[model samples]
Target chain A: MSDRMGEFDLIARYFTRPAKRAVLGVGDDCALLQPAPGMQMAISSDMLVEGRHFFAGVTPFTLGHKALAVNLSDLAACGATPTAFTLALALPRVDEAWLQGFSSGLWALADAHGCELIGGDTTQGPLNICITVFGEVPRGQALLRSGAQADDDIYISGTPGDARLALDALRGTLALPTELLAQARARLEQPSPRVALGQALRGIATAAIDISDGLAGDLGHVLEASGVGARIDPEIATNLIAGCAHAAAAAGLFPYEKLLEYVFAGGDDYELAFTAPPAARQAVDAASRKSQTQVTRIGSIEKAPGLRLVDAQGRSVTQTFQSFDHFA
Target chain B: MSDRMGEFDLIARYFTRPAKRAVLGVGDDCALLQPAPGMQMAISSDMLVEGRHFFAGVTPFTLGHKALAVNLSDLAACGATPTAFTLALALPRVDEAWLQGFSSGLWALADAHGCELIGGDTTQGPLNICITVFGEVPRGQALLRSGAQADDDIYISGTPGDARLALDALRGTLALPTELLAQARARLEQPSPRVALGQALRGIATAAIDISDGLAGDLGHVLEASGVGARIDPEIATNLIAGCAHAAAAAGLFPYEKLLEYVFAGGDDYELAFTAPPAARQAVDAASRKSQTQVTRIGSIEKAPGLRLVDAQGRSVTQTFQSFDHFA
Candidate 1:
C-alpha cells in the first residue's frame, strides 16, 4: 500500500460497479439503497472465522459463497425476499488470486438471486468474513418465530445431515466412500439457502427457522419462541437424510445409529425447518412443487413442556441425543 | 462449551432487547425495518480486529464506542440520519465484565444517535466486532463525493490531528504533559462522528467525506471520485491541529515540523472534510453554526492533476506525506 496505493483504486478494482439497484455504490462513504416501495426490509448478519468456521486450507471461492450463503439462509428462514448484502472482510494480505476467486463465487450467487453488493469494509488481519444481508417482505406478512401454534405440523425442507457427515469425514471421525464424501463435502461448503421455499411458505407456515446449529438445537429456538414443544419421530428423522433410504439398504454411509446422531445433533445444515397448520397441507405441497424443493412432515408442535423424539410406538426416545451449543 | 451453553442464551444475556423502532428484532432469522416513506437508505460496515485495530488491553467500553463511531462517521459523510445497525461478533471467551462494558459503550453511542441495534450474531472465536449500520436520507438529496467542482472552497470539521497525536503519545514516540496526554488519549479513543455537521451540509456542500485515514489520503478519495484535484495551504493544514497554536508557543510536544507531519498525514481523525462552491459560503457558515462544529477553510479544489500542499510562499511542500496504506 502506497500513499499512491489509494484505497479507492483497490475497492474499485475488486468491489465497485455501477449501481444497478442501489442508488449509490462503493465510492461513497455509505451506499444508498431504496427497498421496493411499501416493503419491510429484512436484515441479518453472520460472521465466519478462519479456523472455527472453516479449515485453513479451504479455497477463497467456497469460503466466499459459504459466508454469503449463511446470511442468505437466515433471510430464507424469515420468508423474506433476498435483495442485497454487504461484506466485511479481514485479510492477512492482498492476494489478487484469492480476491478473484472469492469475488467470482460471491457475484455468481448474488447475481442469481438479484441480490446486489451494496457496501462493506475490508481490513488487515487474520481471515474473517462477515456479511449482512437485506431483503424485503410485505409489512406484517413476515413469518415469525412466535407464530407456531399447538398442533402445528412441523416440516423440514431438503436433506439436513449431509453437511455434518462431510465435516465428520474431514475431521477423520468418520470414513466415507469417495463419491459419498465428495457429495457430502459439497453439501457442507455450498449449502443452498431455501429462499424460494421460504417465500412459498410465507402465508402457509406459522413459524420458521433455518437449521444452522443442528435440527434439535434450532428447533429449540422455535420452541422457546412459540411457547410450544415438539414431538419428532425418530425413524422419520433418520429417513430425512438425503439418500439415507437408498444407502441404508445398499451401501450405508454409516450405521443407522450414527446417521440419526448426525441428523438430529450435527450443526451447519442450511435447510429450513418450519411449522404450518395441518389445514395448509395442500398449500405446503404446492409451495414445495413450485420451488422444486422437497418438504418433509417430520413432527407436530404440542402444548407440552419439552421437546421429545418418539419411537415408532410413540414412546419417548430422546435419551441418546445431545443438542449442539456455541458455549457450555 | 456444552449443550447447555448455546449462542442464543449469550445473545439474550447481552444483546436481546425489544427493538423499539424495528418491525421485528432479535430471535428471528432477520430483523425487519422500514425506512421512512420515499427515503433512501444509507448502509456502511466497519470491522475492528484485535491488535490491528486496538490494543488487547484497551477497555471494552472504549473499543465498542470506537467501533460503532467509525461506522457512524460514514453515514455522516453521506448526510444520512442514523437508523439501525447489526453486529457480528466473535469472542475468545465469555467474560461477563467485558460484555457488560462493551454493551454499555455500544448502547450509549447508539442511543445518543437514536441508532438501534436490531440484530446480530455472536460466535465463539478470537475477538472481532463487525457492525453494519443503516441510515436514511431524503431521496436524491444525499451528499455525494462525485459532486465537487474545481475551485470549490474546501473545509474540515473540528481538529484533525489530535487522534494521531494521542496515538504517538501512547506509543512512546512523543511525550505529552499529563493533562494533555489524557485529552489526546480521549481524542484517540472517542473521536465523535460529525453526524450533525454532515447532515447540515447536505444541500450546501458540493462533496463530503469523513477524514479517517488522514486528510490527504481520504480527501484523495473525494478528488478521485469527483475527478478533481486540490491545492492545500500548508500553514493552514498545520494550524488545523487541535491545541497546536497554544502548544507551539510554549513547551512544544515535538518540533513544529513533526507536528505538521502528524497533522497532515496522521490517520484515525474522524473529522469531516468537504467542499462548497463559493456561492454557498454563507450557507456553509450557517450550517457550521447550526451544527455547533468548528469548520475551518483550509484550501480549494483545483483543476490541476494531483494533490499539492503549498507553503506560505505558494510553492509545493507536500513531499513529506507517505499516505498510510492498511497493507503497508
Candidate 2:
C-alpha cells in the first residue's frame, strides 16, 4: 500500500489560497478579474522545460522562481503593473518535498509583486511549467517595441551577461572563481524582474524589451518593429558585462572578445534594453534613481537599416555573434 | 546542410497573424486586451500531454482542437463570452505537415468563437499543449458552483458518456460498430464547448460546472460548494447516454447497468452540468432552444448532504462509482 496524495489534495496543500484581489480564485472553473476602469490588460506566456531550460538536478525552489520571473519580465518590458498569473504544470511524480520548496519560492516572488496565483492546472507528465501572466497598463502609456524613433539614445538596465557567464561556468565551457560564480549563479537563478523601473519608464522610454534571448537579438526585435537600425558602441556594450571593469586585474578572466559575445548574444538575462530621446536623459536618470536600478547608455537609434558595431571613435568593429535559438 | 525552420520562422508561418481584436498581438512582448466596458475577465488554463492526454499517433488536428476546446469549456461553464487565448506548445521536432494540420484545426474552432490567438511561446521539448483562455462576462452575471440552492433542478447539456465509450473502444476494452465508433470518436476528439448555451443560461442557471471529470464528480464539486445534495433518477440518468434511447431495440448494445455507469462516472465529457430553480424550468427550456443545445433534467438539488440515485418511484438504487483523478 502507498500513501500518495491525490491531485486535489496536492493542490490544496500547496497551491490553493483565498482570493485576495481576484474576483474568483482557485477551485473555480474560471477565475474572474476586473481591471480598473479604462485600463488595458497585458498578457504574456513562457514555458520552461527540464534539461532544455535548466539542468536536470537543479533545485525546484529556483526553478519555480525562474518560471514565473521570465513571464513577469515580459510585463516589465511592456511597462505594465503586475497583477495575476496562472500556472499550468506537468510533473512526473508527486514529491511532497519538491512541492513544498517550489510553492514557497513561487509565493516569495508573487507576494513581492502583489501578483496572485488565481488558477491553474496540474497533471502527471514530463516536467514543464507554463505561466501566463496578466498585468495592467493605462491606455496608450504601455511601452512597445515599435515606438523607437531616430536619434533616441539606447540604454540597458543592470548587467546583462552575468547569467550567461554563470551558465558557461557551470557548463564547464568556461571557468570562474567560486565567489564570482556564486554571484553569477544567483543572476541565472533568481534574476529580478524590474517591475518598478518599467512603470517608471512609462511615457519616458520610447521603446523597451527585456533581454531574454540575448541583448543583440532582442534589440534586433525592437529595431525591426520600429523600422530603425542602431549603432552600438562596442566599447560601451562590452563594458555592460559583469566584472568587466575589473577584468584586467582579475586572474582567470576571459578575453574582452569573449565578453563581447556574452554581452551581445547571451540568453537568460532578464534585464531591460530601451531607448529614449536625448532631451529626456535627465528624466531617464531620475527613473533609474527612483527604481534603484542602474541604467547604461550604449548606443543610439539610427535611420540606417542594420545594426552596426562601432568603436569609441566611430570606427567599424568587425564581429559576429549568433543569438540563442531553441530549434536553430 | 539541413533546411529545418527556426522557431521564429515556424511561428510566422503557422502561428503569427494580424491582431484582429487585440490592441497588440503576436510579435510583441505581450498582447493587450481591453474588455468591453463593465465586463469582468474570466480566465482558465489547461495542459495536455502526449501519451497521457492523447494517443501518440492521434491526428495533430484533433489534438489542437481538443486543447483549445477544453480551455474554452471552462469559459463556457462560467457563462463568459469567448474573447481570446494564449497557446504555449512544446514539440519534440518540427514537422511541417503536423504544424499545418494543427494550426488549421486550431483556427477553425477559434474563428467560430471569434476568440483570437493573442500571444504564446513555442519551444523544443516533449509534446505538451497548454492554453490559457480569456473571456468576458458582465459583473455579477458569472455562473459559479457556489450558487446552487436547495430544491433547484439539475440539468445537463448534451450527452455525457459517448466520449468514454469511444475511449473504451479505442483502448480495445469495448466493441462498437464501425459507424457508431466514428460518431463516438468525434465526441471524444473535437468536443463543442457550449459557449452559446452558457451565455443563454447566464441569468437562468444558479450554479454551473463543465463535466470534465465525469458527471458525478463534477456535480459533486457543485454540491460541495453549495452545501447541497442531489437526487438523480437512475432511469433518467442512463437515458443521457448517446444511443441509449435505442438501446433496448438495438443489437450489440451494452447492458443498461453499464450505460448507467458510463453516464455517471465517465470523464472527458465537456458538456456542462448546471442547476436552476424549478420555477425557471420554462426559462431554461427557452434558453436551451435559443442556444440550439439540448438540455435534459435528471435530478433535483436538496438540502441533504450527499448524492443518492433513486428509481422512478423514489426507491434507492445501490451503486458506487469513482471519478477519474490524474494522480489518484
- Could you say which candidate leads in lDDT? 2
DockQ winner among the candidates?
Answer: 2
* Candidate 1 displacement at residue A13 in angstroms: 2.7
Minimum summed lDDT over a 10-residue window in model 1 chain A is located at A241-250
Native contacts retained by model 1, as a fraction? Answer: 0.79
lDDT of each: 0.84, 0.89
Q: Where is the poorest 10-residue window by lDDT in model 2 chain A?
A: A241-250
Give the Cα error of residue A311 in candidate 1, in Å.
3.2
Q: Which stretches of candidate 2 lie over 4 Å from their true place?
A: A1-3, A240-252, B1-3, B244-252
Q: TM-score for every candidate vs. truth?
A: 0.96, 0.98
Local distance difference test, candidate 2: 0.89
Q: For residues B1-328, could you state the per-residue lDDT of candidate 1 as single tens digits?
A: 3234467677887887888988877778999999899899999999989987788999889998999999999999999999899999998887888888999899999999999989998887878999999999999989988888998999988877778777877899777888878877787898899999989998899999998888888888889889889988868766654453236324764667776667667788889999999899999999999989999888899987678888779787756676666666
Cα displacement (angstroms), candidate 1, residue B245, comes to 8.5
After best superposition, candidate 1 residue A209: deviation in angstroms? Answer: 0.4
